[model samples]
Target: AILNSCEYGEGWATDTYEKALKDDAEYLTTEQQAMIKAQHALLKADHDKVKSMHDTLAEIA
Candidate 1:
């Protein structure tokens, strides 16, 4: 269940990021892509950690 939730969150983030990029494609540059990539990675990692914590709590209970 935790894994599923994490995957869903990641997918949502990816879709949102892609949409934003498409919306601003005319103004986005290579540097912007790099910045977005970094931000995306950070978000993904944070989501994963939160999911993991939930899983651990469920295991304890």
Candidate 2:
């Protein structure tokens, strides 16, 4: 749900800004960019931890 919210927020931001410009360029505010970056970092950390656990389990099994 948290990831979904981030995705939805990104989509909304793109629609609200890019649609006005009619271009593929991003126009995120500083705060929006920071928020997205933080979310991505969290997701990456979670993924890395899960992968490490899976690898450890596989080694034991």
Kindly list the per-residue Cα lDDT of model 2 for residues 13-60, writing each as its tens digit: 545544434442267666766666666556556655655665676689
Best by lDDT: 1
lDDT of 1 by residue, 1-61 (tens): 7666876787689677777666876688989977887787787787677777777877998
Which has the greatest TM-score?
A: 1
Q: CA lDDT of each candidate?
A: 0.77, 0.56
Q: How many residue pairs clash (N, CA or C atoms closer than 3 angstroms) in each of the candidate models, in the order given? A: 0, 0
Q: Mark the regions of model 2 whose C-alpha exceeds 4 Å error after superposition.
A: 1-25
